[model samples]
Target: MGFLPNSMLIMARKPGLVEAFAGLGLAVQGPSALPDEIKRMAAFMASRAAGCVYCQTHTHHQAANAGISADKLEALWDYETSDLFSEAERSALRVAQSAAQVPNAVTGADMSALKQHFSDEQIVDLVAVISLFGFLNRWNDTFATALEEEPSAHAAAHMAAHGWDAGKHAR
Candidate 1:
């Protein structure tokens, strides 16, 4: 069901590339700096903006596993005044939103607001998260990858356990 010649299926043929993307994802969403939960939550929000249903479904599952509440998930789209998120989370979402909106409007005030809640290193990681989702959104949207679709249960299980580094993606 892809726009291109089965690009999703084709990506599976390159597990090394999948692994590489996962590494980047791990670096961005890993527990080393940014909280994996917050990273996944930001990804969910960006996926919504990108209209990538595949990313949304996968990230929704990931966010659930990370303990993101249903209330928070429901309010993610209008988080500016939502009481579900902490100040830190709101700031990160602001950054993610700016990045996801093509021709990003991330301003100095946005950066400053985010910086107040995160270290410089973590800010770098946050930007990486946004960038990754931007790439994922385009790929999923372009390929017309189906939501809830994956090559195999084994692949989904691996990715669920290992995060994006699990060597599987929609496109």
Candidate 2:
């Protein structure tokens, strides 16, 4: 809602590419069975697993804005055992964590676990959230995109204790 993030700004230079990605972004983020909070949380964790400081800051900021509590966000790394999370949330976050790995660690058992909590369509949307961040993580990390003040501050406030920082993305 503020100024476009640096990734979008860079994408803006290629108008068609930006527009295309925006359209896809809208689709991935559009109305679905999954709530925005869950999707944003998956994105935050995906960005974290991908080790993209830029995306991590941005997604964590978004998750917070979507009403994800500070304590839950802090406990995301341990979602499997965190009392703050539901079984459905744990399954989805597990997918985010594994799917973001370099070799993609998502397993059939993981899918089975997710099926217990999510509909096929909902799973698609959930995976889309993770997939979108997969691309974003690579894009931002490759560019060493400058961390913006708002998201950087948000991450510092909420995620610094989790070993998160501006890192290579520092402006």
Candidate 3:
């Protein structure tokens, strides 16, 4: 049987809040100087760093749809030393990881490095991707949201080797 994720259903309990959250997420995912692949990758990295299974699975699925390779997704945790990522992708991933840390570990050096590779507007988009996933990661984790089937399967097939598990978010 099909099911709505608990996170969305719970948010739906407050229609206005759900609508507002969805609106803001759409805005963040809208067209930008930053490529969709980069935004998706950044979001995935943020979700992984946040340790939210539901968000991680969802972002991983989206990242694949945005043209990120299975190899890249599998190796994302090591992007800092991976040859698959470009300098710009590495910079963006670093920003995602730092920003997603608890207590907000992002530093000036992180932003400076990002600036070397991205325009100010692009940096904004990267931050927006991280911020969007940050909200989703907290919401899904708090709700123990059940993973949707597609993302669940995708994560199983592609993310398991990277230490991904459904955990409390299992469907």
Highest TM-score against the true fold, candidate: 2
Each prediction's total of clashing residue pairs, residues at least 3 apart in sequence or on different chains, is: 0, 0, 0
Question: Could you give candidate 2's per-residue lDDT for residues 52-159 as a string of tens digits?
Answer: 999888887877787878888888878989999999899999999999998999999999999999899999999999999999999999999999899998888888
Candidate 2 regions exceeding 4 Å error are none
Instruction: Check candidate 2 and list the clashing pairs.
Output: none
lDDT of each: 0.69, 0.89, 0.87
Q: Which candidate would rank higher by TM-score, 1 or 2? A: 2
Residue 170 shift from truth in candidate 3, angstroms: 1.0
| Ranking of all predicted structures according to TM-score, beginning with the best and ending with the worst | 2, 3, 1
How close is every model to the real structure, measured as TM-score?
0.76, 0.97, 0.94
User: For model 1, what is the alpha-carbon lDDT of residue 56?
Assistant: 63
Report the candidate with higher TM-score, 2 versus 3: 2
In candidate 3, what are the lDDT values of residues 63-167, reduced to their tens digit?
887777878887787899999999989989888988999989889999888999999999999999898888889888988988888889988999888788899
Clashes of 3: 0
How many Å off is the CA of 60 in candidate 1? 1.7
> Which candidate ranks first by lDDT, i.e. highest?
2
